[model samples]
Target: MTAVETPELDAALAAAEARCARQGATLTPLRRQVLRLVLEAGQPVGAYTLLERLKERRGPAAPPTVYRALDFLLEQGLIHRLERLNAFLPCIGPEEEPCGHGCGHDHPHQFLICTRCGATAEIADHDVAHALTAAADRLGFRPSRATVEVEGICARCA
Candidate 1:
């Protein structure tokens, strides 16, 4: 909605394009547009909202079309599903190496979600990972996926 340009978003779009090329998949115009919208948002975006925008820009779109594109993006790790909010956000960094069951091999960065505005911010901290590892070791369990999400009001909202 804002015209601000973010370096992070530029990098993400480049990464997505590269990934699509490497996978021999064409990032169609519609798909590219949708991805751009999500990246520009800098927060979680609902599928229905994406659909509405797509319809406005492209004229007459179906939910299936948007969902299909989203599925493709997610599969390629270009986007991530925010399960708690039932929304989607563009992935910020390298694709996490998948950890099958619970071994902490591939983990998503922690998210600080703003309850008031529904904005999601990524939190990267080695200490938090270390603490989780230590706790898991004590329980004789290794986490395959490590995601930490904290929800509260953001400064502006507060």
Candidate 2:
């Protein structure tokens, strides 16, 4: 199950809301609901799943509506889109990243994905970032995006 009732979750929401306010962005009720679902999911959640859940309460909502909310959440650094699963997960990190894209997508981070339970964690470390950059340098590559996902079992699942 997703982290249903935790202090960290509460803090995340509060921080997100505050950040949105600071930037003159609206974390609308609908967007907030979507963020909650993704966070409580305890794993990556697909757009379809989010749409399904929204329909249960709101009735006959369109995919674009959810996507728009998702995009807003992503821009505010409240959630992230998992590249591998094409799913969304909460941004559980402590600080904000530069917003060249006005979204956390520019943030260099790594994901530890639990293949067994589907639980995911986010990590932002300098060493790992350097290693990625160094490897890319070997090929004279300029990295644009740097979100990484590794599939394995988390300690809880293991």
Candidate 3:
């Protein structure tokens, strides 16, 4: 498995630290480990999954220990939470800012979820989101989030 924490990992970490600095937040050691685990997994992972992994390396890690870090990462947009799967995956690239409501978090994205190997990839189309949101406004419909998860087998699995 190609670990996501490869050479690109350094750039991601730097971007995250800069973003936190702007937001007056600190990337604690525990939070950094959580982010590393998610990225290294190269797939969506649940909090318990991370907790178990952490325990193997750092001894007994409580649920709260992992949860707190997950929460912080989510708030910073260093990671994305898949509502349907109740799991999290790292964003495609380094994020310079948090993805809050209206901060482009609603950017239309088709999350490709691979069932066989449990991998996930987010395909975002900013133009599509703009067009869809505009059309909705004309029809008097308000849309908040534009992310959609499409499930299927990945090429590797096939």
Best by TM-score: 2
RMSD of 2: 3.9
**TM-score-sorted candidate list, best first:** 2, 3, 1
Q: List the residue pairs that clash in candidate 2.
A: none
lDDT (CA) for every model shown? Answer: 0.71, 0.77, 0.74
Can you give the TM-score per candidate against the true fold? 0.72, 0.81, 0.78
lDDT of 2 by residue, 1-158 (tens): 36645665666666677778988998789988888778778778999999999898789999999999999888777777899989988774323322223345555778898888787777776688889999999999998767888999999978
Candidate with better lDDT, 1 vs 3: 3
- Candidate order (lDDT): 2, 3, 1
Q: Which candidate would rank higher by lDDT, 1 or 2?
A: 2
lDDT of 3 by residue, 28-146 (tens): 87888788888788778898999999998889889999989988887766778888789988753543343322242434566888888877777776776788889999999997666
Clashing pairs in model 1, backbone N/Cα/C closer than 3 A = 102-143, 102-144, 103-143, 103-144, 104-143, 104-144
What does candidate 2 score on TM? 0.81
Tell me how far the alpha carbon of residue 16 in candidate 1 is from the true structure, in angstroms, after superposition: 1.4
Q: How far is candidate 3 from the true structure (C-alpha RMSD, Å)?
A: 3.7
Error of 1 at 12 (Å): 3.9
